[model samples]
Target: MPLLFLRRCGWLGLLACLLTACGSHQKAPPAFTASGYVADRGAMRLWRKDDVAQQTVNIVSVYSPYKGENTVITRYQFIRDDVRQINRTQNGEHPETLQIRFDDKGNPSFMQRQRDGLREKLSDDELALYQFEARRLLDVSQSLRAGQVILMQGRWRNGVMTTCDGNEVDPDFDRRSASWVAARTQRSTGQLGVAWLEAPEGTQLLLVANEDFCHWQPKKSEL
Candidate 1:
């Protein structure tokens, strides 16, 4: 009986050690990530930062229309999968800004909108729509991440490209695409900004313009 008890104790100790080893090998999720998708008439870029300790998430999305000059940027703040606040800004001929905050019970605590230099009130339907969109975008971000789609932005100068974070990268551009980017860069008076999407399948160029996109990009600390 004594020997059997000792063996049982030994087995329990081994099981605990094995569990501890597995826990030690487990990897923590990344704190920051980015993803994007092609919208109906344009493209949208998303950046997300997670506060694991606080159980919160912050996401920023930029939508640029293909034919229109308008650019829409939205920020969503979430507390454990529940949206806490949303801020949106549209820039173009008719600029607008909208802000909404929700209480602990998910009720709207504050809502405001300003368009064309005039302050306006948001209707209940509009508020609901914004909340729905926020949830939809969160789902979209999760899908993109699961599919391993990544968004990258950089500056192109004299045939060399430096990423927004200042890392040099050689994008997988074919001959025709490379030539076109080079031509555009040469024709532009200022440094050319480039944004692209990368996945296991291939790389797709999203935008190339004279304006610097890094200027307004959110950093990890800001998120």
Candidate 2:
């Protein structure tokens, strides 16, 4: 009976050692999600939901050519409930997915705009103010874990059109922009020829998008 007891004790000891070894091999999570934004090479720009306008934000700027006397009006408006991409560098690197619940408020910190091949960060003074407001609105007193990585990525079907100031291209129809687009248009031809709705000439176009595409509308001020 003593020998049997000793054998049982030996088995228990072995099991404990195995468990300890396994625990030692396990990996702790890479970083806390509350750490804010995850830097990625592929995505140069990162935007947080908090930066989105709670009501509406508008800015009008002027664009001038280096030599020509021509000038263009640039208007940017941000508004509420507008969901835009928060991660993207456009640096030609593979995009890493952090399986995250995007709806969760206040983590990424601020909206970042990258330009000059990701060499420069464009500043949005208003967005900074909005970031402050977002923090004030969110209760981030509790800590949170980083998002999980999605092993299998999602796929999408889309229409593409590319053009320059003097050039034009056409694309197929997509309903995202309007109820008519996805339904009426089968195929498209000119980039400048995109579906158009007439309104007063002076208008502010609000855009929300990632690298995929832009959804724009004339601000209520213009309407």
Candidate 3:
């Protein structure tokens, strides 16, 4: 039968040259995820790991609920997981401490922080959600190829409190400032935080997020 059709076309030409030499021996890099607001070198300052021991840092800065004068700073850190390591660098400028470890299926398996050159201030949609989470961690480098998710939607500003002059007051839990002028005549919705970083770029992820709001009592401001 024509020598079995030439041995089935020589086994389909050796399976297309071994699938083109395994797609040129694979290649791709650059990635990140652990959801926004991160700074590490073993914890130089700024972190957000969702949970493990809880964390929140951004030490100081006051005002700007809506640019009453443009001032915002209040930093702090300590994350639960999302692997980070860079530990030790106290005063070249900022970030002076950090240490973390977590993985074994909990994700962010190891971390360390510190890199004294503090420079944190991101907004413009948090730098387009950190360049779409470093391009979705370079398109899911691996975890078998996919497995890392983080999504956040806005319109929340509950109870406000972080003063020592760093602004954002509502001490009574919120409700004053001339009755918050009927909460600016009601229905405002403005204050956002969005994230979607995937993680991959020498793994050392972090994301310690925090939010609080619940003090809106306005129903009487008819011009």
Candidate 4:
């Protein structure tokens, strides 16, 4: 089992540290391939509207605070590969009023307004779907985030000055219901309201922080 230690060296997990994923060359920063969560509250632009369904958010995860809900408002086209990764996991029902909240212990649970028979803790395939949708919204938030969320993977070596902060890797994130992520894409009515509708399913994003912290932590259910 990996012991999560609260250290001043930031959130360099013991696994990554043991693997020595850290670097300090001063010039060539690592190009991380990871997903950022829009679980936090933020604003997003209407990047592209899905004239077909009229509701759907493509990506998420940003450094700065935002003013909008989960809506794509820009047409930037940055993270190509990250979009592909998110696309691979985008084959599921788009939630209308779904909200994912965490318990006191940092375990994950969910509640959607219109869904029936759904529980706070999901299981097996149910859990998978919840994660898929959660991650999808998070990725959409990442794409729309104005800038990159700081991320670095490596050992806290000696004399290696880095601007990387482990804000994403915090294991204790989403500890309360208020910190839970909630998103509801506005579905278009036929060809009308296209401006507020979600973008195409596979459109590329403009900017995304390669932070991997929000990827696997906050397990789906409490043990």
Candidate 5:
């Protein structure tokens, strides 16, 4: 009877070990990742989505100027590391939009630009610049990801902020910045949201507004 009891205990221990091993290996790589950096005159947030089955990558970048009301959003789509399409939209006093599609050989297959209610073709030089910028941003994103620089957004209520992923966090902001955020939150009639970037260097506040940033933010399906 004692031998049977010991055998039962051994089987239970082996089952527990197997379950733990399975759980450890069950974690899958995330389908999407986000990173960003502070530009010279503003902050730029980057969101990237990877489609492993399609061998495609999509990156959307939003650049908000510190002093101007202008906001620029650029989306780049790549197939197997080659640029496939680029779309950019700028909103402000002088709004403009650009769309470019490249062929499999990396040649522009379609291009269009609209400004001030006028449609125009991109000059060769402008097209080249856009292509260059797309590649440069991809390189920058790779470096940012490697450095673990990340962008996070959340809703601010009272003094607590609930992250988009449903986690509560106390962002590392300067006293003045915190006060400014609180003031804005208090003045806003709608839900106030905040965005920040985290890096090994430090944390930096990106934006504070009444809009629901996560609602319109790019998702894996949209990418």
Candidate 6:
């Protein structure tokens, strides 16, 4: 009896060791791609409604402050690949929105919005969407104009970054209602909206960022 019990304990320890090793081998997610578009450049044009007036604005790009200020009225695009989309709307105004699309294999497809539509941004060989969006944002913010394409580059310290500030928590955790309620406390905060585009069989998901717009840490359900 003693010998049998000792053998069982040894087997259990080996199983635990194997499980832990497998868990450690799990891979982390790829870093986000970023780029900025030049809104003032001659090649690209900002979308303006016919009813809007055509004023002679400054040649320099104007960026809306993340806090305590009105909209900067610049045109910038923030895009992730096949993972999410973040659209902004405020006081009846429709701000720019981001979109992401994925391929059948569950890998992301680099796509871009052209002629007011989305097309693959990168070929299968070149998969770099985050870098493209980051650069586009920087260019637009740096030299914003009425008619130009600008994209911005940002990093996700924990989860992701959106145009709005003060909302840093990951906007992806919808199941945690308690956390969502706490995030709304900061009325001035802006959260990121996520949409997964699985092309041909695409799935659209909307993720709301926390009040800080920096971290994407989802709270525990019980908490």
lDDT of each: 0.77, 0.26, 0.26, 0.26, 0.75, 0.28
Q: Give the per-residue lDDT of model 5 (tens digit) for 123-182.
A: 889888998888877766655555455789888886788888889999887777788897
State the lDDT of candidate 6 residue by residue for 8-118, as single tens digits: 324344233324333333343112221112122111212211111332111112232323333332322322211122122122133332333445454555444322333
TM-score of each: 0.82, 0.18, 0.17, 0.22, 0.79, 0.17
Which 10 successive residues of model 2 have the least lDDT summed?
Answer: 35-44
* Stretches > 4 Å off in candidate 2: 1-103, 106-112, 122-195, 198-223
What is candidate 2's lDDT per residue for 25-120, written digit by digit as tens?
Answer: 334433111111111111111111222325532332222222333332323333453222122222223222111112335333334444443433
lDDT of 4 by residue, 1-223 (tens): 1111111112233223322322222343122222232223432222222212422323332222243233321111122212211211111243223344444342454333323333333355754564555444443433322222222221111212122333222122122311221111122121110001111111111122222323432221210
Alpha carbon lDDT at 196, candidate 3: 16
Poorest 10 consecutive residues of model 1 by lDDT? 1-10
Candidate 1 lDDT, 1-223, residue by residue in tens: 1111212324334233324333333344467888776665677889999888999989999998877789999999999888999999999999999999999888999988999999998888888899888887776675555545678999998778899989999999767668779889778986898888776546767777777988978888888
Q: TM-score: which candidate is best?
A: 1
Say what the RMSD of model 1 is.
14.0
User: Can you tell me which runs of candidate 4 are displaced by over 4 Å?
Assistant: 1-100, 104-106, 109-122, 147-192, 196-223
Put the candidates in TM-score order, highest first.
1, 5, 4, 2, 6, 3
Candidate with better lDDT, 1 vs 3: 1
Task: Please give the lDDT score at residue 99 for candidate 4.
Answer: 43
lDDT by residue for model 3 (1-223), tens: 1111212323233233333333343443112212221221111111222222343111111112231222222222223322222222233323344333333343334443434544444345643443343233222222212222221212224433332224453322123332443353244454322111222221221211122111211111200
